[model samples]
Target: MLSKEEIQRYQRHFPLPDFGVEAQEKLKKSKVLIVGCGGLGNPVSSYLAASGVSCIGLIDSDVVSISNLQRQILYKEQEIGISKVRLTAQKLKELNHHVEIEEYNLNLNSKNALSIIDKFDLVIDCTDNFPTRYLINDACILQNKPFIYGSIYQYEGQVAVFNVNKSANYRDLYPTPPNPESVPDCEIGGVLGTLPGIIGSIQANEAIKVICGIGQPLIEKLFIFDSQSMETRVIKIKNTNARDTITGLIDYEEFCHPNKNKMVKEITVKELHEMIENKEDFQLIDVREPHEVEIATLDGELIPLGDIPQNEDKIAKNKKVVVHCRSGARSGQAIQYLQGKLGLENLYNLKGGILAWADEIDPSMEKY
Candidate 1:
């Protein structure tokens, strides 16, 4: 049922014996929902849209910052501070007028995960954080949809297929979310600009194959590619009984961990600015890694998370200690460790960490 223009446009696809008009038609009929339109989301959506996916749903609660241009291909410097999903949708539709682009410019939370995911036949997990990735996996499992998972860290990237027809899932592979502090991010762990492009393209390829039921999908297997070494490895994942306990969608926050995040007193960026303006005497403790400090940093002592115990004595005990990281999470963990574990009660977690400082107090700073 393709238009004359569509037929001629995809004539190259028609010549492939296995993927003729039937596969093209299947692709046109497929609805693929891509969550997290960041690094991986860029190429995943671009290729799928170019492949002529019928309906492409984009979910992201992020804005296009100047730093995202290095890897987020869908955005440009001109589009900075704009909504990611909205801009991605416009660009994707412009790429191919026949492709329907649905933009959900909201954060995917426990409340909205099921409803949003169920609308699409497949979901792609391009999220950077662990919480959303787990949420996507669980939602796809509950909704009985296939999911393409891709992640980038430094010079390496990983792609996996999970929750397809009750195949092995993320839980079977990891079974638990790592402690947030233990994991490194692109800000702390830098990625090559081309790294996500490689991984995301692979994810898009897998997504289309799964949609058209053409080539063998990467079901229950993890594909690991290291751009630095130019090596690729595939590991088989076994299905687990984790689904037995998952009858319905429970709170994803509590599912990842408990309702209890590390307990810490926090001070907002405005409040911190006030303290600075008022010339208050407080010691700022930046608990981010050395590399992260190099990117965008606050004026503070650079005692990393791992070095806290050894350098506890170096932490200024005379002044009120304000602990911070890229965001507040690491600082929260640091505060909890200092107070709950190490018995230092005078620490406060900066509300949004250095990123907040960049957005509100200081616009000169750069971060991912």
Candidate 2:
């Protein structure tokens, strides 16, 4: 059913033995939903569009920031502060006018996950956090759609095919979410710029293989790659009874963060500024990495989040202690650990971390 121009455009694909006009036509009929428009989303969407995927659905609420330029290749410096899904949709349309692009400039949560995913033929997990990943897994399973999973950490990345033919899903690999504090995202733990490109391409390839019904897709197997060593390995996943437990979607955030009910106390940057102006007797702790301190700092004692366990004595017990990071996420994690493990009652999280201080208190300070 391809037009003459379409045949000529994808003529290169017509010569392959198994993947010829038929497979290309299959691609032209497939609908894919990519969750998260960050590093992994960039290459996955690009290649799938270029390969003639009929429709692509992009869902992400985050805006482009300076920190994303390192791995998110689809964005430019000029596009900073713009919606990521909207910009990515425009770029993909420019790449292939034959493909349809759907943009949802909103975060994917339990309330919207099932409805949105049910419209697509398949889903791709490009998210960086555990809660969203679990949300995608459950939704895709409920909709009876397969999903491709990809994740990058520092120099290592992982890719896997889940829920194809009712096979193993994410929960089959990870029965429960890990402690949030133990896992650091790309912002806290740096990722090589080229890592996502490699892993995402593999994910896109798996999607094509599944759609076209051609070669062996990575069903029930996880692909691990290390860019630093140029090494690769595949681990076979055993299907479990976990799928029986997923009858409906629940609150993923509360599920992943078991200590959500035990809220941490927070102090605004203005309040901290007032305290500093008043010469209050309080301890300020920086929980960011050493390299981050070099860029910008609040002159607080350097105790990175990882080192808090060993240096618990350094945090003053008698004085009010304020913990901060680039944003408040890591600092909140630090305070949670300090309070839950050390039973410290004097800890407080600096709201919005150093970025807020740079914006409100010290306008001259640099922000990452």
Candidate 1 on 146-264: residue-level lDDT in tens?
Answer: 98999999889999988777888888988887865567577656689999899999999999888888888889899999898899999999887676666766666666656234556
Error of 2 at 351 (Å): 3.4
Tell me the tens digit of each residue's lDDT in model 2 across 1-368: 78788898889888887999899989999999999899999999999999999999999998887888988999999898799999999999999999999899999988888889988999999999999999999998888899999999999999999998899999999999998878878877789998999998999999999999989998999999999899999999999957788999999999998785466888999999999999999999999999889889999999998899999889899999999999899889888888988888898899999989988999788777
TM-score of each: 0.91, 0.94
Off by over 4 Å in 1: 257-260, 288-298, 302-310, 336-341, 361-368
Q: Each model's number of backbone clashes? A: 0, 0
lDDT of each: 0.85, 0.91
RMSD (CA, Å), candidate 2 to true, equals: 2.0
Can you give the lDDT of residue 332 in candidate 1?
Answer: 77
